[model samples]
Target: MAGIGPAPILFNEFFQMFMRCMPPNGWPVNSKIAVGNSGGPDSTCLLFLLQKLLTDLRSKTMARQSIPTSVVSLSVNHNLQEASHSMAARSAANAAAMGIEHLTLDIPWGTPPFSDKPVASQSMEQVAREARYHVIFDGMARTGAHSVAFGHHADDQVETSLMRLARGTTELGAGGMRRCRRWGMGTGDVEGGLGWVGHHGLDRWIIRPLLDVRKDRILATCEEHQLDYVNDPTNFQPEITLRNAIRQMLTLQEEGKDMVLSLLIITQSALSGLPQHISGSLEKIKVAAADLQETTMDLEGGLHQLHGAVKVLSSRLEDVDNEVTFHLKNLTLPSPPSTLILSSHALPAIVDPTVRLALVLRVMRYVSFHPWGSLRADGNRRRTSIQRIIDTLWQSDGAPPFTAGGGVLWQPAIFSAKKRLRVGTQCLGRRLQLGERFAWMASRLPAVPYNMLDTAILPSKLDIDVTERLASATSRGDDFLEVLFDCRFLVRFDLSQIPEELVEALRKSQETGVNVRIKPHTKYYWPKVVLRKPSCVDIAYATLMDNGQIDTFGHAPWVTMKYIRLLDAT
Candidate 1:
């Protein structure tokens, strides 16, 4: 792939690549797309190519319908170098020349991490990348763009894969950057903050349509169109960044350079396709075993029900011997709202470690509380960590409850059975057949620190007028407070729905100069709050109106809470 050097990206090929990387939910008509244009060859080319693709599509279909689709150019001024502002300005000028809307966000260099002395360090490149994406995401959301597209090309992908390999990453990591994925954690950090528009805890996407196009080809496209672009001097200095170093290494004049580069690209292409294939196979297994409830059922819920039925039968002397004769009533089991279940029987017959690792990561991402805490980048150590858990799952007696990445607690399904070989009425037994019917349950590790909550002061009236910082545009001027709890659940509290008595009490407290505070009702939280069908958790709050008077409320009808997949393991 690398040997197929620079060539102008044909419109058909660019459109195909763009469509291939489109979100599962295809781009809506009349929706806006934000391009990360940095006045560079890659980004500038991408902005133009994307505009061309959308334009072509509209001219064919959308144009007839009179629906309009739009593109906007977004630039993040990191302010890391003297030319940062000029580069941003240049990008804006290029976008203007192309008749595209452009916006530039200047980073607050005076901020903590940026302000800290010696801001330029080994990690500076990564910091800037994270900050850039953060600004881009916020810019997209505010501008009504559904997705943001980047200009990472084929060369970047190879370099990324090589870096991951050098860092001892897993097979998935070695596969390199995904063509399309949810915009997630900041490199090594989990995004969280108040008044920060980036971490809105919604399912936003990042698209890299040019991942298959080589950088040289992109530059060629720019030249073919007479589009202007600037080369950042820092990118030429290999000593300044790891990516630059890799780029320099690949471009070095050597006897086997082309062969080595070609091989690397071919290997990455293969590796990148493996994950999707394995995931599809796993889904087939889950579907085939759904009827048996052996693999498709919730682990803990099934085990609890099995145990409950056994206990009920054991109490009856007649039913104990004649298990199939009687049916138990009012016996039920419910799983935690945030819990995910995986059964050993769901796995394929083969013992490929990559498949198993993918399965574990899927569950981890589904149940993990913090996006920053995933094991994706932990490298070889991560494999070892996950393998230990997998090894335990394969044991005859089953593994004890343990914690895993993303603040997930894995509990091995336990059962007590006196006998087997019966339907619907067998005493559950401990130590089921290994890799047959054993199950593992994953749930959010409880009690995230409530430091994000504002405990400074209580409002005069405990009404639907809390801080506006947490409001989402989806609220549409509604008096509601939204928060991403544990980064696992989107918890929205409707201030407008407060009870009249609580509101009156708060008003009274305010007039009386009573020092009040709003706090989480710790007693009604996880492990204490019973979870049932429909898969949603209740969050409670206590308003301390005065020394003795306290009002407590649970998010039931007023507040809408649900889970959002913040990190896709891929």
Candidate 2:
């Protein structure tokens, strides 16, 4: 696959840099890297060079140098240009010729649902970027790839910085793109801090090996190697897009090479230094996280420790079995039900404001089961609001329960009455429900077992193991459960536990004469209602006899169902 070799020293340096990005800690031995290939010079250069690096590493006899990096080239077709699909095909073909694995995705690249403007006039580049990353993340998920390698060079960094600056972004914008970070699926935001949140922590490292490489060297290498790549004409159309405009400006600055290169280095350093920058800020937050506990009405507390102030320890939780509550130290505390309270003086011990905000963000994330980047299209906006809410809570009189983050509500421990005030962390979703079987958040993605009675047997097609995995995939409290396989169906899992006011609107079918059925929840969740004469199992059996299919929708005033199909595996 090579007609020419990249400069030995230059290639070796960048190769080592990419190798270092591999997690030093435990990772799958067969860790795969998904290299984005756009059939363009920059991407082609990175791809071929990576191919050479892996080949050399594996071919070596020395144990120390024998690195086995499973690699795959991903070509995403956004249907932007007329020949875009053909370009993607060529990318896959090139990977085939080089004996590397390849994956091609046909993404719908029209105006994104996240977009505000009309389809015809919307920014194709922005929409394409989002679509491309979504495909990349999904491909990584399916292939078990650990990190995504991009061909973005120093020039790309310059362009991103300039574009964000022109649009008036924050300090993060000044740092340009992160050298290594985590990108979660369906979550548009990228996270640079500690910890991983996805089921397998797949939302990880966005490596830019070419961050230090110049655009000119990349083009030269690709040409010298006779690599198949196309120069995107869109890059020269500066007036059409901000990034293109930055690129055009860079071409006119022959004397400004050092300055541009320096700026890139500065941006890279700024991003990489952030972890160390905030390292000291989380100490107090960590302490608070470890201090959580549950509580109640006409509160009482007996404590012996530093300061003697009460702690609604973050370490305590009501449902110990729930994954979200796995870290709690006590099930019950001196606070209200569905709430954890700490001495109001708890945060004052740590004076650093950054640490306080970080701690609050951590608590919110832990409670919400949402990682740093889980916010949807409005990620930045939501984060800003979250920060604002934290600030407001910090300043409030510490009495009434106030809504903080869009999804969370906070209540400060009552002062004077308690001998002193205690800070409270209450799940607002829970309080509104008053008395329920599960938390309000859980109702959003509900999943109850198929068995409603002792005799009810799940259809054989839903393998016991797969079914368990599928059931776990659905949120226990979430209202909608979509099973995306052979026994295809969408359901509104029963919410007898949730308050009547927070109920989800049920789904109604538009197609007439299509046999529709209403299924029931697990017998344990709604024992009384399901115990009545006709159970969900009975209805399903009746449907099976009539239409030869056991599938049915949830039969409830609040239950909405779609695409119900129950296949009999046996």
Name the top lDDT candidate. 1
lDDT of 2 by residue, 183-209 (tens): 532342222111222333333557777
Worst 10 residues of 2 by lDDT: 437-446
Clashes of 1: 5
Candidate 2 shows a clash count of 33
Q: What is the lDDT of residue 509 in candidate 2?
A: 15
Error of 2 at 180 (Å): 2.7
> Which whole-number lDDT from 0 to 100 does residue 192 have in model 1?
42
Q: List candidate 2 segments past 4 Å from native.
A: 1-9, 24-26, 60-68, 108-120, 141-144, 166-168, 188-205, 223-226, 253-366, 369-372, 376-379, 382-387, 390-400, 413-570
Tens-digit lDDT string for candidate 1 (1-570): 556656899998987788777776666667788899889999999999888877777768534233228899999888777888889998999999988988898777557434432364566666676567667777887888877889988667656654554555554554566677666543333234312332342456778988766667898899999999888878866555556654554454222445345334323542233233222332332232232211122212222332232223223322221221111111111234555544444433426555455555555665664453234322224756788766765555455577644556667643223322211113135445532345566665544433522233322211123322322322455576655444444555566764444444444543543222222323112211111112333233443221223334553344455555532343
Q: Which residue pairs in model 1 clash with each other?
A: 416-428, 417-428, 417-429, 464-495, 464-496
- lDDT of candidates 1 onward, in order: 0.54, 0.44
